[model samples]
Target: MRLLVMLTCLLAGCLAEKPHPCESPPLLTGALTVSTQNEKLWTYTRFMYDALGQRIRLMELGTYENKSFSHDVLALFREATMYEISYHNRTCKKKPLKTDFQPLAIPKDATLLGQAVLGSSSGPGQGLLVNTWTGDLPGKAGKYMNTVTEFGCIPIATSYQTSEFGWAVTSFFNNVIGIEDPGLLNPPDFCPDAEMMDSKVEPIDFLSLFHGKA
Candidate 1:
């Protein structure tokens, strides 16, 4: 279950947009692509955000050996809650999950790779930032090399390679930011057994994000 949470966070984080002040709001929606060296393992993701810069929805659809599965996540940041509905073997179970919606800080050891224009389906911008770092991934032994890219202070891409794994995983965010539909913020009725999971994460000041240049 925690693995699923981390996956969603990494996928969604790669597409995170600069946090906006409460007075001025914006919405973001886009598809996320996750791929690895071995073609057999991959995922297709879609995520949505509300005006407050909170992630409202994230869905991951995957196909393996001609079979498919999905993970649907719905979040209520104001209520400090998260829901995860997972599908496997044609069955789905909804569980309460824990998370901090606040932006994750870049590790101090990460080396800035200089800023440049990152052109992609997510749009081209001159201020896109990139950094390289080495760190231990969750639930994985040893350290890995990671490269992170950001636009408007929000991460737009992340890639990592580890010697032990013999493969690299890369995630990309397709830029699609605009006004979001209010109805999409609500959780789907299909997931009825959502329960809260215990966690000790703390929230950060969202407005202060992007204060310094990358």
Candidate 2:
């Protein structure tokens, strides 16, 4: 009985540490559009990056009922910092970012779903299904997972799910054409709290925006 218990313990440890399939790190940097099933515009995010996989800029653009909204964040890895600016449609509350900076990396619990053709970009990319812990999926205790699709080692799409709503690709973007917009990496003069840069931003409401349209 003791031997049996020891063997079971060893097997459980092995399963707990499942080996990840060999995959190149994602170099996602460019404009990405995320939406729902009915082609409703959820988020239009533009990204810029340096030689490393560091995200330099993340610009989110959206239009709801004939109203346009824009919010963005600037990431300065070398400075170990990032700045978030919110274009409050309802209120102009420019809350500062509060999370500390850490090097970007893939989720450790992510499992490779497989390779498939995605978007108009050439070449095949792998999908990472991450088991995330957010109070979104029903009975999931806020712990749910989603698949992240990447192209050419760059993330092109993913479906974000939450318990407040059903599973869907809340945010994703295609046609990630390269650009040289230096100004995008800089916070505007109106954003006086650049020194208080951090790594947090407001979450986009993907389902609420697509009310009747979906």
Candidate 3:
């Protein structure tokens, strides 16, 4: 177990198997384009600010194939983006510690994506409606086609100083590209690492994240 943790500290720019799942919901506040061999989907989850590093509003639009799915404003997260996350070390089982949110940064295509919802519909009450009929169909309802939809889609610990922990994190953060591993079939070590070195986000400039909040 100790050996496993040591390996993670030594390796970066790739994935490593983390024992634990995401302890908290992802702090999503930007645009995400998810594509597979079958189809492509673009999602724009609108985000508003509560404070410097906190979020207040929430809204989203997902487009799969040609149909569109708009999401309702459900909940808000305060300082999750800025708060440090400490849980079971996913890469190494023996290590127990907390890591801060990689200071949010601006996405590369910030200007094009963050500007508006692309390929989206402007329909009213455009979100989903949950209507289940056991034996009868509701009065004011129309039939719809298509039920199945295609999918998606992090990182990781980063210490301020290398000496802060057993391993040093000269830089710790993730980019929106290539952040998934399927298990032993595809270990984190095999997956590529986070991209914050050539990134434009500063360690403390949280609002700048509003640009690449994905």
lDDT of 2 by residue, 171-202 (tens): 43453435456565655665654344222644
- Better structure of 1 and 3 per TM-score: 1
lDDT of 1 by residue, 108-176 (tens): 444444444544446554355554445555456444444445433344555555442245454546746
lDDT, candidate 3, 1-214, per-residue tens: 9998988777852564422211122343333322222333444544432223333332345555557765422111332223211123332111111223332332222221111222343775453221111111123232211111111112222212111122222111222332132121121341133222322434433221222222
Quantify all predictions' global Cα lDDT against the true fold. Answer: 0.50, 0.45, 0.28
Ranking by lDDT: 1, 2, 3
Assess candidate 2 and give its TM-score to the true structure.
Answer: 0.46
Clashing pairs in 1: 122-175
Candidate 2 ranges beyond 4 A from true positions: 1-28, 36-41, 49-56, 64-68, 75-94, 99-105, 118-152, 168-179, 193-214
Q: Which stretches of candidate 3 lie over 4 Å from their true place?
A: 1-40, 50-53, 65-67, 78-103, 106-214
Model 2: lDDT equals 0.45
Each candidate structure's TM-score, on Cα atoms with residue i matched to residue i, is 0.50, 0.46, 0.20
Of candidate 3, the 10-residue stretch with the lowest lDDT total is: 144-153
Best by lDDT: 1
Residue 50 C-alpha lDDT in model 3: 26
